[model samples]
Each structure stands twice: as structure tokens, then as C-alpha cells.
Target: MTVSDQTLSTAGTEVADGIVLTDVAASKVRSLLEQEGRTDLQLRVAVQPGGCSGLRYQLFFDERALDGDIVKKFGGVGVVVDRMSAPYLTGAVIDFTDTIEKQGFTIDNPNAQNSCACGDSFH
Candidate 1:
């Protein structure tokens, strides 16, 4: 999809294609990128094995894109997902939440059939 600057401007507070980034999540990522002084970094999300549920979620900052990767932009941030993990992450939303009991980024994935109690693993 074609994302304009205006679209990214509203991303922190709006949901698009069933995916979204909360203000806190966006801010945290932006801050880290600023500190690193790298404007090429992108948020990379993927699904891998080795969890209780047979699959685990992976999130990190990356600067490279592989062939066949699906790239998306939101709120001036780039999101990259490899072909192998795209099916599992489609329609998933990434957000940040700070609560008394927990604080961090979270993924709301509709494609998940089962998730482990720890909330880090899914299948």
C-alpha cells in the first residue's frame, strides 16, 4: 500500500489494516533510532520456532531488506517482514502499553491459534 506522510502522522493514534502502533510504542522506537543516529533502521517482526507453542515472536531494529520481503510504512517508520513470516503476521497490530504489572510492546495477532502462558510464544 502507498503510505503518505499524512498517514504516518496519524499512525500513533489510528489503526490501519488491523495493525497499529500506539503513541508510546512509536515514541520509544523513534527515540532509540534518534539516539543511534540512524534513519535507515526499520522495525522488523518475524515468527520463529523454539517456544512452548511451537512459534515465537521476534522484534528488532534492522537496516537491511531481503528479496521477497514485504515492506510497510507507518508514521514515518518502516516495518519489514520476510516472506516466511508474512502469513503469520498479516493483520497483526503492534502496540506499546505501560501498566502497573507490565510494560512493553505487545502484538495483537489474529493469526495466532494458540499462545503460551508467558505470552512470548504462539502457534
Candidate 2:
């Protein structure tokens, strides 16, 4: 696969398959990594089977460089997506939202036709 040609004027939200990491989310990820006192780990995003929808997302810190990984950087934080998940996550935006209702990382996936109630899974 190739990196998407589309890009936003705001900042470094551009990446392979059009997956974007917003500035706020990048800062949060940097803070979380700093708290752990390690720079070796990179944020890894993957799609796995399960959840109410056909696919579920998995986000975690990882150091291994899996084959065919799509790598990108946002505010010094590294984000990795596996080859298989890249297509599903194309044009997706990863953001951090904090409000009275909720606070945490969020994925805005354009590819998903519909998502479950919790919003943890999509198809």
C-alpha cells in the first residue's frame, strides 16, 4: 500500500493511509511515555477480531518492529500501524478528547460503516 495524498493544513497529521494523530493526542501520548521513563516504546495500533462489531482496535506501547509496519511521527511520538490494519484505518483521525462526558483517546474512522455503542469496535 501507499501513503494517501490527502493532507490537512493544520500540521503533521499526515501519514500512511491518511491516519492522523492530532496535536492534543500526540501530547498526551508523549506525556504518558515520559511518565513511564522510556523512549524505546512506540505507540502501536492494530485491528483484531472481536467486539460487537466485526473489528476491534488495539492501542498499546510496543518496541518491536513488526514486518510491513507503517510508521509515522507526531510531536516526537512514534505511531505504528500494521499492514493489515492500514486499510481499515485509512483516513482515520486519532484524537484526545476531554469533557464532562468522557476523556481519552478517540479514533474517527471514516472507513467504518457503523460502530457499536461503546465505540470501541467498528465494521
Candidate 3:
């Protein structure tokens, strides 16, 4: 498989096919990495079945790169996606918000035709 180093932009956020980590998101990820003190960790993003809307997302720090993993680097942070979950996560944007009302990483997935009420699961 070919990995493109080219960068795509959405709302000023850099992107790739499977996933895009925004500037704020990347910064947060880097900060978290520093806190964890683990250089081997990479952010893993995956799409899994069995949510109310038929699909759910899993995002976390992973130390192992499984077989068939698609790895990309964004602003010094490594993001990994497995082959199976790649298609469903294409054109997805990950952003971090620090608003007073809500503070966390938010995902904007164009592939999701429908999503559950809680915004955790999508089509």
C-alpha cells in the first residue's frame, strides 16, 4: 500500500484519507504523550460495529502497531488506523475543544450518514 505525505485541508485543519488530526488535537495529543512519558505510544483510531447507529469509534493511545496498520504522522504525532476501519473513517476530522460548556476531542465524520443521540455512535 502507498502512503501519501500530501496534506489536505478542511476548515484550516490538515487531513489524510483515513483520519485527520487538527492543530489543537495534535497539541493535546502531544501534551498527553508528555504526561504519559511513553515514546512508543501512538494514537489509534478505529471504527467498530455494534453501536445503536451501527458503528462506533475507538480512540486511544496504543503501544503496538498491529499488522495491516496504516500509520500517519501529523504535527509530530503518530496516528494509526487498521485496514478494516480505514474506509469507514475516511475524511474524518478530529478536533479538541476547550469551551467552558464542553471540553474534549470531537470527531467530524463525513462518512457518517446518521448518528445516535449521544453523538458517540454513527452510521
Candidate 4:
């Protein structure tokens, strides 16, 4: 696994098979962490069995590392993926956008055969 300071979707680096964190997302995460005054926290990405598409993604700040967790660092941000969710999230690229239509994080998952219209769940 390699970490790069460059933005995602470029020839920068690949941290894992399917999980790529874009530069914008990393910067946003860092900004959020600074606002929260917590430097020990890491971004936890997980897949839960719910949502309209049968599986939903969970992203949050967590300080604890559970067993079988895969941790990858991009710049000053750390992305933690659980063992079970790795397969489902493999080849997924996470990005953040702030435009007039959308203003939040987005996930692009190649392993997903289908996703809901709400863009919150996938199968």
C-alpha cells in the first residue's frame, strides 16, 4: 500500500485495492478534526446491513481500533476499514464536493452491483 500527497484519480498512489481517499476528502477530514480539537481520531469506514440497497456505508470519527481492522493513511488523515467491509468496499473511491447542487462526501464503489436512488446504500 502506498500513500501520496497528490489528489485522487491521478497517478499518485493506491492505498488499497478499491479504497481511495481523494485529496479534497482528506483535507475536509483534517479540517473537521481541527474543529473538533481531536488529533487522535481516525475516519472509520464500515458497511452495515441496512438501507434500501441492502448495505449502507458508515463513516465517522473513531479513536478505537477494533480487531481485524485495516488502517491506511493519506497525508495526515487515516481511514480505517473493518475486515468484513473490505471486500464490499474494495475498489471504492471516496470524495468530497462542495457545489451548488451537492455539498458532502461521496462514495464510488465498483463492487456494487446495484445501489439505491438515495445514494446511501448498495448491494
Structural similarity to truth (TM-score) of each candidate: 0.82, 0.88, 0.89, 0.88
- Candidate 1: what lDDT? 0.75
Candidate 4 pairs with clashing backbones: 18-90, 18-91, 18-92
- Per-residue alpha-carbon lDDT of candidate 1 for residues 5-120, written as tens digits (9 for 90 to 100): 33333634544444566666777788878999999898888889978999998989998878876666665677777878878876787887779998888998999998999998
lDDT score, residue 25, model 1? 75
Candidate 3's C-alpha lDDT? 0.86
Which parts of model 2 have CA positions greater than 4 angstroms off? Answer: 1-16
Q: What's each prediction's clash count? A: 1, 0, 0, 3
Q: Rate the local accuracy (lDDT) of all candidates.
A: 0.75, 0.83, 0.86, 0.83
Query: What is the number of residue pairs that collide in model 4?
Result: 3
**Residue range with the least summed lDDT across 10 consecutive positions in model 4:** 1-10
Give the runs in model 4 whose Cα sits over 4 Å from its true position: 1-14
Q: Estimate, for each residue in 1-123, the C-alpha lDDT of model 3 and write its tens digit.
A: 334457666675677765779989989999999999998898999999977999999989998868888888787788889999999888798999999899998989999999999888999
Per-residue lDDT of model 4, residues 6-117, tens digit only: 4344654345556888888889999999999999999999999999989999999999878888888776798888889999888898889899999999888888999999
Q: What is the lDDT of candidate 2?
A: 0.83
Clashes of 1: 1
Better of 1 and 4 by TM-score: 4
